[model samples]
Target: MTANENNTNGYLVGTTLERMLKAGHFAVTGELGSPQSAHGEEIRAKAALLKGYADGVNLTDNQTAIVRISSIAAGAILVQEGLEPIIQMTCRDRNRLAIQADLLGAYALGMRNLLCLTGDHQIFGNHPTAKHVFDIDSIQLVQMVADMRDKKVFQCGDEFKGIEPRFFVGAASAPLADPLDFRPYRLAKKINAGANFIQTQLVYDVPAFAKFMEKVREMGLHEKTSILVGVGPLKSAGMARYMKNNVPGIDVPDEIIDRMTAAGKGEPWFGKKNAEMTKEEKRARSKARREEGIQVCIDLIKELREIEGVAGVHIMAIEWEKAVKPIVEGAGLYPRPSV
Candidate 1:
C-alpha cells in the first residue's frame, strides 16, 4: 500500500486533498509562491486569498533557484492560517537526511501533503554559483517518502523511532516534454514509485494533452493515481509567447497565443498605429489581456474535465492568487468540495 492508503482504520492519509480525491470530487489545487523575505504576514496574506478557493495550497520550495521563505516554514504558517498546505520538497538543495528531518517536522507542523520535485537547476536561479545536491532524483525521493509512510522505515532501512510521517505523496509530470513518446513510460515510473497524485506542467493545447492522457489511460495509470492537469492564466500575450517559444515541455497552441494577442489589440490595427496608443490605453489593454487569460483558463479547465483520465485541475495563477476565485467559479468548480 502507498502512503495514502495506510491510515489506521482504512485507506487515505487523512489529508483533505487525499480524502477529496478519494471521494471523487473534481479537485482544485492552487500554488502560493513564497515571498523572498521572512515576512510571516506575507505568507498569511497569500493564504487568505487561497484558503477557501483551493482544496490544497502548494508552497513552492525556492522556485526558480531564487532564495525565498522555505516551503516548510511557509507551510507551517499556512497550517496556522487554516488551509491545507502542500510542502514542495526538492532534491536540488538537500540530502536524504535533511529531507527526512524536514518531512518529520513538516508532518508535526500539520502539513500532510508533499510534492517531490527535482527543482529548477541552480543555473536558472539568482545564485548560479551555488552548488547543487541532487543526492537523489525526484523519483527516488518519492519512493523514500512513501517508504517512510507505509513501511514506517527510514531511507536507511531502520525502523522509525516513533509514529511515521504519513503524507499524501505527490509528484509532477510534463505531458508535452521532449521525447514525447517516452513521457507515458516515465510517468509509470513515478506511479510505480508510489505517487498518490500528479500535478503536471501547464498545458494549453487540449487535443495534444488528450492524446497524452489517452496513452496514460491505456496503461491504466489514472486508476492508480489521481491526475490533475495544470492550467494557468497567461497574464499577457508576451507571457503566452514566451512560454510557447522558450519554455520546454509547455505546448501553447498558436490559437492561444493569437487569442492573447487579440485581447491586447482590442483596436482594429496591428500595425504602427497601435504603437501610437497612449500609456492609459496600454494599461487598459494589459488589463483586458489578463481578463481574457482568466477566461481561457476557465475554458481549458472545462475542456480538461471532460477528458477520461483527468481527475481535476491544478490552477497555477502564479503571483495572481486573487484571480483564482473567479477562475474556479468561472469553471464551475467553486464551493470547493468539503471532504
Candidate 2:
C-alpha cells in the first residue's frame, strides 16, 4: 500500500520514512541526543550535520531518563529544518493522558514516525530521588498510537471530531539480551501491538545476533515488520569493555576489544604498562581506536545488510555525530533516498 493511504498529512503523506520502508528501501536512521541546555540552535546544528546522511533522525526522549528538551519540540524543529524525525516517547515520566496528548502534539508538528520505549528506571538517571510513572509499557503505547491512527479513537474509546494522527509506529528490541530464546516471541508481541518497524539494541556479537535473526526468520516475523539492526562505533578498547561489562542488554565480544587494542598499539599508551601515561597520550590512543571503530562499524553494516530479513542499519554514533557521514559513505549507503 502507498503511504498516502495510511496517513492524512499532506506534507508527510507519501514521502516519509513510512513510504521509504514500504517501498523496500535500505533505510538508514541516526539517533540525535538533545543537549542538556535548552539551546535550540545546538539541536539544529547537530541535526544539520546529519541532514544528508540519514533518512530520518531519532530525537531521543530524555534518553537514559536524564532530563532534556522534549522530543516533540525537537521533532518540530527538525521538521522545520527539512529533516524527517522519529520522535521517541517513553513511559517513565508520563501517564496515559500525557502520552496521548503529546502524541497528538507530535503529529501536529508534522512528525510521521514514532518510537515507543519503556524507558530506563529513574534510579539510572542523575536524579535518583525522582519517582517514575510507567502507567503503560512500550507495547501498550504502540497499540494506543496505532489505535488513534487506525480506529480514530483514544484508549478510552473516545472518538475525535477531526483528523486523527497517522504515525508509523516503531519499538525497540534486544536480540542478545537474556532469555535469548524468548526475544523473537517478544518481537512478535510488539508487532501484534502495532509496531510497524523495530530497531535493535547495539550489537557487537555478530554470531549471537545472527542466531537471534535465525529465530526471527523462523517465526516469519520479518515478513510482518521491517527490522533495522543497530550498529555503532566503539571508540576504544576501554569503551568496548565498559559497554560489555557495565551496559545492560549489550554483548561485546573479546575479539572486538583485541582489535581496538591492536589498532592503538603504535601509541605510547598502548597497554597497561603505559597506564601512567599523560592525558594527551591517552587521548591520542583513543583517537586511533576511534578510526578503527569506524571501520569496524562499516564492516558490520556491510555484513548486516547481506542477512535475510534485515531491512537496513541504524547507525547510532552517539555523541560522535561527525563520524556518521564517514560510516555511511564507507558502508556504501550514502546518497540516501530522496523520499
Best by lDDT: 1
User: What's the C-alpha lDDT at position 119 in model 2?
Assistant: 94
Candidate 1, residue 244: the lDDT equals: 84
State residue 103's C-alpha deviation in candidate 1, in Å: 0.6
Model 1 RMSD, rounded to 1 decimal:
2.9
Tens digits of lDDT, candidate 1, 182-215? 9999899999999999999998999999999999
As for candidate 2, its clashing pairs are: none
| Deviating ranges (above 4 Å) for candidate 2 | 1-15, 267-283
Query: For model 2, where is the 10-residue window of minimal lDDT?
Result: 4-13
Q: Estimate each model's TM-score.
A: 0.95, 0.93
Q: Which stretches of candidate 1 lie over 4 Å from their true place?
A: 1-9, 264-275
